[model samples]
Target: MAGLAGAPADGVAQYRRVVVWRHGQTSWNAAGRFQGQTDIELDEVGRAQAEASARLLAALSPGRVVASDLTRARDTGEALGRLAGLPVTVDLRLRETYAGRWQGLTFAQIDEQFPEEAAGWATGDVTVVPGGGECRLDVAARVCAAVEEHLRGLPENGLLVLATHGGAARVAIASLLGLPHDRWAVMSGLANCNWSMLEEMGPEKATRGLRWRLAAHNAGSLPEPVTVQEG
Candidate 1:
């Protein structure tokens, strides 16, 4: 992530808040397949997850919805858009790292077939391009670019709901937070339809090197049930 991240600045608050939402699960995800850039639709559970998460996120008053152009992320974004009455803007830059030859392969299959390559990426090499797929740093670079561009257009106090893949979300966040490549995987993957919240802290907290605060991570839950009291 070269130009996407910057040194800590006592700069103005750029983004009010960012909700990085991972798209719901597909059969590939359930089967532990490397679903990079493959256009897999949501399964039944995935659809439910999207609907549930969308209901919860709508309460946050998201002013914008942006998502990867893939089918899984797009459908998840559509759920949020339908609920929040917003429109989804698709960006190919937000797409998951192209898995290349591993596009439709399962974890076991990759290990058995391409153990060396799988081990390299699994150990956080970040440079190892699985089956000649996009490198982790490359994914970070593009995702950061797309997300930062979207944040710039948001008004003050506006929340941006971003629907994308788990890998893309992890890379983008790690880059924006200025974390080293080796430590990027320390941030766990987001479960299907789960979300992480990043807040742009104002300059009052200048002592902190970075102004980005991870307010929430792996948050997955629907809105609380509405119960009426009879007096």
Candidate 2:
């Protein structure tokens, strides 16, 4: 809604809107296991959540639906693609952070076995490589690259949907908005099947060195107009 107001006649043509939707819940998710790049399928609740969320997302009339090649993300994207009649595009770069030795471990297990690493991660240290896996910056770079590639041919005013993982989505949004690494942790992790919205701002309106602005974060509902009184 913030991006929809005060636009020139061709304003809509100047930028594109992106919806970064986190894949629905998986069995690992329910059990608090780290699923980095595990290629897990959606559990029953995950599938149902995807179906429900897809119906809502379809109303936004997305022009493109792209997702991580991992089964959970791919399946989630496919749900929307089916409703929107768009084929889902798979991109491996959109996959979750390769969490190396931490994969398949529960949170408590990590805390017990890798106390230092777990502690750093708990503090939102973007530099922590997660059991020697990809750092947040690494994840951000690849995710942003994938999003940029998909956005290249997007039409003006069109929407692009990304069905991705929670960790990947968090870093992507922070990096795209040009937030400092320390501030990246300010954004909370997304819930299963929830999404964040971003809109590109024309040069005239963009913040210094930033191209995209967050329209919504960790959201399940569609965009709505906001009314505020100025002092």
Candidate 3:
């Protein structure tokens, strides 16, 4: 929303579009478990979701595929990588927020065990360190950094898809788009196998303090051109 919309600039390219994809559902997800930094694999439903969504994303012809090293994220990335004929580059920085003691606990269980922390986390409090785990800001920092590194290899008009967790995707999108930590809660969580897209606005827009523009969020389908009728 912050950058100009039109055809991409010509000549040497330094910017690229990005897709931050959330991994498909695991058994833990259906069970309402925290699963933070847990190496959970995709369940049957998750596999189905990944296969279907991969078909859709593969149409975009993504140039690079990257993912968290965790099992769930890696498997999800593999789905797309297989279709796009790209290898998934794994990075520990892209892992979900390590929720320390909260990992593997159900939402209700977390509330019963860590009442105050659960309350704060539910409100999207960036300062809340879940069970003494990484805070939202910390997650954003590392996630965006990994994304930036991958962007360097992206070609002109190329798309880089990142298969990661819900929390990681949300925080990374907010941080990369220059949204303050307090505004991060405005970004709704991504459903299983859904994705968000960001487009770099080139150096000209960066001079105006607008770097990346969010093209889509929590989307299951590719974006289409908008058509409006003049009244």
Candidate 4:
């Protein structure tokens, strides 16, 4: 409601409402592995989480669904699309930040194998990662760009949904809120199936020229009983 703006002259939708949600939990999540770019499928519980999220969004009745191309996000988006009866568009730019050599490893393992990188990240250094993986700043820039591109195409008053990963989502949130990359460590990871909302305001009211206001941040999963009732 707060993000409503005038439509663009070209009839391309201006900003209205955007919902950002993290994909459901994965097997690797419980196993404490760094799943960046690993392409793991959702486990049984994860699937249930995805279905529940779909039911929740269906109640909200969004106009469009967009998601990262990764398996976890795609699966989640598919479930939501099925429930909401909306088409799902995949965007590779929304994919999770690559962890490089740190992929599939636990925090303890990373600390043991790549001590310097681990320590740098632990200290909130945004530019450091093992091997060639993306830094927090890099992830923020690309994800912000992707969101901007998606928003530019939608009509004003449109409701849109995005399903993505934790790290990239965090970076996007920090960018939206104008927080420094170093603050990424202080922000909590988006829970599995959690939702956040943002609105794009006009230039005059925008804090950063291109106004991106966080309307709802890190909302937890929809209750199963409520979802069933809505369905």
Better of 2 and 3 by lDDT: 2
Q: Give Cα distance to truth, residue 106, candidate 3, Å.
A: 0.6
Q: Write the per-residue lDDT of candidate 4 for residues 165-227, one digit (tens) a residue.
A: 988888788787777665767766788888787877766677456677776677754332311
Which sections of candidate 1 miss by over 4 Å?
Answer: 1-15, 204-209, 222-231
Cα lDDT of model 1 by residue, 1-231, tens digit: 001122224563455888889999899999999899889999999999999989888888889999999999999999999999999999999899898999899889999899999899888778889888889999999988887799886887678888999988998888878788889879888999999888787677646778677867888853333433699
In candidate 3, what are the lDDT values of residues 129-185, reduced to their tens digit?
999999999999899889889989668688899999999999889888888777888
| Ranked candidates (TM-score, high to low) | 2, 3, 1, 4
- Model 2 Cα lDDT, one tens digit per residue, 1-231: 222333335423557899999999999999999999988999999999999999988988889999999999999999999999999999999999999999999999999999999999988898998988989999999999999899988997778999999999999999998888999989989999999999888776664666788988888765455565699
The candidate scoring highest on TM-score is: 2
lDDT of 1: 0.85
Residue pairs whose backbone atoms clash in candidate 4: 13-154, 13-155
Could you tell which candidate, 1 or 4, scores higher by lDDT?
A: 1
Candidate 4 global TM-score:
0.84
Model 3: clashing residue pairs? none
List the RMSD of every prediction in angstroms.
Answer: 7.9, 2.7, 3.3, 6.9
What TM-score would every model get versus the actual structure?
0.87, 0.92, 0.91, 0.84
**Candidate 4 at 172: error in angstroms?**
0.9
